[model samples]
Target: MVKSELEKLGLHFTNIDLGVIEIKETISKEQKQKLKSNLAVSGLELLDDHKSILVDKIKNVIIEMVHYSDELPKVNYSDYISEKLGYDYTYLSNLFSEVKGITIQHFIINHKIERAKELILYDELNLTEISYRLHYSSVAHLSNQFKKVTGQSPTFYKKIGKKRKSNLENL
Candidate 1:
């Protein structure tokens, strides 16, 4: 639908991905205005500033790698992000920290914990498997971080998941 709208507006886009778009040609101010207005009507807002766009791209990359990818990278995440975005790791780190007020590493850890919770709830993988899947050094390490973030062990979280499912079934 979004691509269709861009096409209808006579914009030539080379690529479109989550939160990012590539236009084949420069768009006029009128075209941009029309595109923004059209997108707003559909509850989507175009990113107007460079910093906001970069921040969003950083977030998208992290989410994709940590939560959606089948395997974690062999390289460090900072190196991966820098290589992917073609920016210096230090600069990216500083910009992300300044704009989001949280270090990128912290954000990655939070996301990893969230993904761990999801895998635990799914009951498809055990703690050791989850540990390796998320690229944790060891099961003990995964547990420590899980406890630090959620104040609950993975075992307790799984029990909670079971109880929640049972409650839903009762309803």
Candidate 2:
């Protein structure tokens, strides 16, 4: 979608990834506006500010790590984000909190909880396996966080999934 939008505006980008775009040349205000408007039509926004771009990069990294990666990294998340973004963890934490109104740890926990929900709904892994896959210390730890974020136990979520599935089949 983004590439097509860029092409529609005759813009040349050297690279495009999850949250990064490298244009071959500096775009004029008109082109930028057109690109922004075009992307907005597709439910995307152009991040022009440095802080917003950095925050978006942070989000993309976390999302990729949690939802897409085959396995969670075996290092501290702060250290991982710091090393990946080439900034101090404190600075990243402060910036993320200021911009997102949530700490980085909170963001990670929310995403982890979301991923846990997905695993539960899939019914492919037991809670223990899901805990290990998500790098929680134990099933209890995963369950606690899951309940904290989602207001329900993993078992409850799984049961709701089953009920929903049965309802859909009956319909």
Error of 1 at 37 (Å): 3.7
Which tens-of-lDDT digit does each residue in 80-171 have in candidate 1?
99999999989999999999999999999999999999999999999999999999999999999999999999999999999999999999
Prediction 1 TM-score vs. true: 0.86
| Highest lDDT against the true fold, candidate | 1
The runs of at least 3 residues in candidate 1 whose Cα sits more than 4 Å from the true structure, single-residue gaps closed, are 7-17, 24-31
lDDT measured at residue 128 in model 1 versus the true structure, 0 to 100: 94
Candidate lDDT (C-alpha), each: 0.94, 0.91
User: lDDT by residue for model 2 over 68-146, one digit each (tens)?
Assistant: 9869988989988988999999999999999999999999999999999999999889999999989999999999998
Candidate 1: lDDT of 143?
A: 99
TM-score of each: 0.86, 0.90
* Error of model 1, residue 110, in angstroms: 1.1
How many clashing pairs per prediction, in order?
Answer: 0, 0
| Poorest stretch of ten by lDDT in candidate 1 | 12-21
For model 2, name the residue pairs that clash.
Answer: none
